[model samples]
Target chain A: MIEVKDLRFVYPNGVEALRGVSLKIEDGEFVAIMGQNGAGKTTLVKHFNGLLKPTKGDVYVDGVNTKDVSVATLARKVGYVFQNPDHQLFCESVEQEVAFALKNFGFDQETIEKRVSWALQLLGLTQYRQVSPFMLSGGERKRVALASVLAWDPKVVILDEPTIGQDYAQKEKLRQFIMQLRTQKKTVVIVTHDVEFVAECQPRIILMKNGKIVADGSAKEILTNPEVLLQASVIPPQITQTFHYLKDIGLPTNVIDVYEARETILEFLGETKK
Target chain B: MRFMVARESVEVIKTEKLTFTYAGRNEPSIRDVGLSIEKGEFVILTGPSGCGKTTLCRCFNGLIPHFYQGKLEGEVIVAGLKVNEHPTYELACHVGLVFQNPENQLFALSVEKDVAFGLENLGLPREEIRKRVDWAMKVAGVYELKDRAPYELSGGQQQRVAIASVLAMRPEVIVLDEPTSFLDPLGAKRIFEDIYKLNQKLGITVILVEHRLDLAAKYATRVIVMNDGRVLLDGDPREVLSLEKTRLLGVGIPKATRLYQLLKNDGIPLKSGKVPLTPEEAAEAIKEAFKSD
Candidate 1:
């Protein structure tokens, strides 16, 4: 579980990114934090892994105050995947890249290899195990970065903008990976602007603006409310917009994901949806 | 080849059998790409990452031969000037390139200084630079943040500053390569609106490279789809987006178009011949198709 109590953080340049924010996440819960640029989403999540300590208030991860733990110590409990994969990748090969963190946490050689292989296979990077990550495409690099973090199997995983530059098929695979993490009983927190992906994942939504939490609720509630999302520059997922269009046809109006939208449309056309 | 033509031409930019291979790389970034842009056209170029969209943009502003070390083949003419012959500084007067990352483009401490950097580099006088800087800042909607440092602003604000910096040059053509990659959809929509306004109000040639087809496809008069260093599809937004090959190439079809596809697959007829690119258009089309209900 993660607990943030009245968290506030001011950068050295006097930018107040987080202003008196408070939140809590139970174990194994998936939460998607949605907001516009510079809405304090990244700043708030950095507190989870001790990357940024709160200026005022406290953050407790697994009952331990983040203030008292070093970033390296918190790595065992929390894994953060930055928005840009290039920012964090440094290893020569994809295999070595995934093994770095596991080795750092003092895992034995056998365990490290097993975890690295499993992670690489899970993210479909097995074929490029010996290749340098620098030569990979943007989507492949993102998967490598994600595999590296997942290799360690940190109790809590946080991803920032996991869907940027990803194609439709790639996004579907990423959704499967997010679900896999939940099956492992790991806490998943995603910071992103891809409302469609958010609707597909269907996690708890947290919308922020100007260093404050504006709304928190189910994906159906927050995403369907297009006006609130538009205020922060987040458009609802495509299916929800389609459902809104079909409201005049007496089709289902509350659909958020593609499957429901597809079913509703098929029914409206008098064809049973597959 | 007399690419640096003396005679006036209708095409502002043109490329014939253009192919470029990056230095120390085996394969070509762009392959046999034949393209042309008229004086005032808003073209959206989209493809998966590493599809050579950025490399093609570099060719227009002379960055391909000037800054990047690469072997170029074929002809590229911008404002009737050969890209290989003219210097980048000279091409800057005709074409301006705004990169994806704002931090990579912004160097001056203050936003005002950054916006004025291009004008000053052109040897413009102080008063003229000031006038152009103020005008560009106001147009890009970053006037209030002029005094703040570039690092102090948000991603969207910094992108606005980048756009203003390029606009201060007052080039005949502006090429933005995913200028809104860092912001949310709404923020990106706002930035796209600003660029659309610039295209409408000033008649500046705009070439925007982006992946968010849902938000951007509506603003474009033309769409160019690329994959594996080749143009896979190019036409009006509706025609290109409706192709089956486009979806197979992993291009992000606009959501409204997807909804249309779903309806078509369900044996529902569309009222209009063209696929709807926007939500409102989609709604209108859907209402017409199901009028009997």
Candidate 2:
């Protein structure tokens, strides 16, 4: 579980990236933090892993105050995948990249090998295990970065913009991987602007604007309400927008999934035919 | 008499049996790909990662055979000059390629200096370079940010400055590779809008490589889908995007188009028989369907 208590952060350049924000995530929860570029989503998540100390209030990760623990101490419990894979990838080969973190956490050689192999297989990078990470494509390198983080088996995983350079197929695979993580009861948090992906995952949505949390709730509640989403500069999913436009024709405005919207429209067509 | 008023359609970029294999690579990156793009057309080139999208773009500005040290076999003509025959600097004036990352393209300290960097290399007069830089910055909507350092601006601002730098060259053709992957939805939309204005107002031939088709589909005059180093689909946006093959190739269909397909599959017909590319169009079709009933 992760919790933030009225967290306020001020950078050395006098930019108040976060302003009196408070939130909590239960164990095994899947939450998505969304907003514009300068909305402080990254700043807020960096505090969870002790990357940024709070200027005011407090951050607690697994019942330990973030201020008390070093970033290395929190890495054992929380894994952070940066927005740019190039920023985090330094190892020569993909296999070494995944094993570096496990070795750092003091895992034995056998455990490290097993964990690295499992992670490599999970991300479909096993075939390129011996290949230099720099030689892979941008999307493949992103998978390598993800494999490296997941290899550690951190209790809480924070992914910053995981869908940035990924294609449609890779995104589907990522969605399935996120579900697999949920089955294992690992807490997952993603900061992204990919509304279509978020609509499908349906994680608890947290909307931020100008360093403050504007709204927080289920995807259906937050995504369907246009006024609140507009405040955070989030565009609703296309299916949701279609329903919003069809509200005068007796369609509910809360539909976010395409399949659900299709079924509802089919049912409406059936009734209108009578 | 009819020819007097009709505008001539000139082919700006043409590739014939274009095959390129990078040095030390067993297989070719792009194989036997042939296509022709007319001047002033907006083309969206998209495919999955490692599917030869970037390799094909590199061929446009002579980067493959010259700078990349690749085995190039094919004919590529851009702006009346063969790609392999002329140097990249010569082609740079006619075809401006903006990379995915804006930081890679920007090097000067300030935005104005970055915009003027290309013109300076071309040995243009100082007065001419200054005028073009100001014009490009205003057109890219980055005029106010001319004094700010490249690292100080946000992602969207940095991307705009990058566009300005390319626009300053006054290139006849501009190719952007996934330019909005770093921006939010709104920022992406704004960037697309700015590019659209450039294509519409200035008649610059655009080859935009992107994955976010929902926002970009509405603006494309033509959509080219590539897979496994092959041109899979190319045609009008509606016709190409409506096909089942494009969807099976893992290209993201516009959401409005997906909704149209879903309704069509379920034995329901929208008022407009064509696929809607935007939410507004889909809503209009839905309203018409109910009104007729």
Candidate 3:
């Protein structure tokens, strides 16, 4: 569990990235933080992992104040996959990269090997286990970065832009992986601009703007609210946009899922039993 | 060759049997890819990851054989110059390649300096550099951020600055490798419109590598899909994007197109019998279907 109270943060250069943001993420909750660039979405998530301490408020992670605990201690629970894979990938090979975190956490040699193989296979990087991470493609490298983080089995996994540079198939794989994580009841948080992915996942949505939380609600509520989404610079999913544009034809504007939109349109066309 | 002599050719980019294998890699990244892009065409190159989209883009601007150590075979001619024969510096004037990551390309402290970097390297006059810098910045919609450092800006904003820097060179062929990956949908739409306008007004051939087909499909004159280092499909956007083979390859089909397919599957056909690539087009098609009934 993580909680923030009136969180405010200012960079050393005097740029206030977060302003009095307050939110609470319950245990095993799946959440998505979304907004335009520079809207303080990343700033807010950095607090969850104790990467950035609040300048004026407090962040509590697992019942401990972030200011009191060191970042190393927080690492055991929170695993952050950076926006750029290159920032975190430094091991010589894919296998070593995944094992690096487990070894650091002082896991047994046998456990480290098992976890590394498991992570590589889960992310479809087993074929590249012996290859250098630097030699992989951009998307492949992203998977390597994700494998390295997930190897530690952190309780809370925060993925920053996991869908960027990924293709449709890889994204589907990631979506399934996230669903599997949910079955295990891991707290998953993602900061992204991939609305289609969000529409499919339907995680609890938190919309931020200008360094403050503007809206927080279920995915349907936050995504279909045009006024709130507009303020955050987020465009609704294509199905929602299609339905919204068809509002003049008496179709409902709140449909975010494609299946729901299809049924609603069919019913409106007098082709279905309502 | 230090100087380039203009050749009157309508085909801005052409590749024949182009194959490349990175050093120390057994498998080829690109294989026997043959393509021809006319002047002023906006082409979207999309594929599954590691399918050689970026490697193919590098071949257009002389980066594949020149900068990247690779075994290259066959011919690629961009802006009438054989890429293997011309150095990157000479090709930079005609073909500007915007890298996948904006941070890799932007280096100046301020947006203005970054936009002017390419022009200054060409030994352009100060007045000309100033004029082009302002014009390109405004075109990419980054003029308001002229004094801000690139690092200080958001990912989307920095992407615009990178594009502006490339535009300042007035390259005839601009190949952008997923330039708007960090931008929001609205911002991405605006950038696509800007690139569309440049292609229309200046007749600059655009080769855009991207995966956001939901937003980008409408702007592309043609769509090319690759799989496992081979061109699986290439043609008009509507035709190419609607292929089952393309969909099976895991390319992102525009949601609008998907909706069209779903409707068709349910026995409701749009009046045009064509796939809609954007929401507005889909809405118009549905409205027309309703009116005809």
Superposed by TM-score, candidate 2 places the C-alpha of residue B143 at a distance from the truth, in angstroms, of 0.8
List model 2's recovered fraction of native interface contacts, to 2 decimals: 0.57
lDDT of each: 0.87, 0.90, 0.88
Q: What is the C-alpha local distance difference test score of candidate 1?
A: 0.87
Pairs of residues at least 3 apart in sequence or in different chains that clash in candidate 2: none
Per-residue error (Å), model 1, residue A134: 5.0
Of the pair 2 and 3, which is ahead by DockQ?
A: 2
Q: Model 1 over residues B40-132: C-alpha lDDT tens digits? A: 789999877678888899999999988988899999999999999999988998899887778889988899999988788789889999999
Clashing pairs in 1: A233-B186
RMSD of each: 4.0, 1.6, 3.8
Best first by lDDT, ranked: 2, 3, 1
Instruction: Rate residue B75 of model 2 by lDDT.
Output: 95
How do these models rank on TM-score, best leading? 2, 3, 1
Q: Sort all candidates by DockQ, best to worst.
A: 2, 3, 1
Instruction: State in Å the error of residue A18, model 1.
Output: 2.2
Give the per-residue lDDT digits (tens) of candidate 1, residues A1-274: 9999999999998888999999999999999999988889999998999999999999999999999989999988899999889999999999999999988899999999899999999988998898889878776899899999999989999998888767666787888989988999999999998876787789999999989999999998998898888777788777778778778777766788766666666567664222
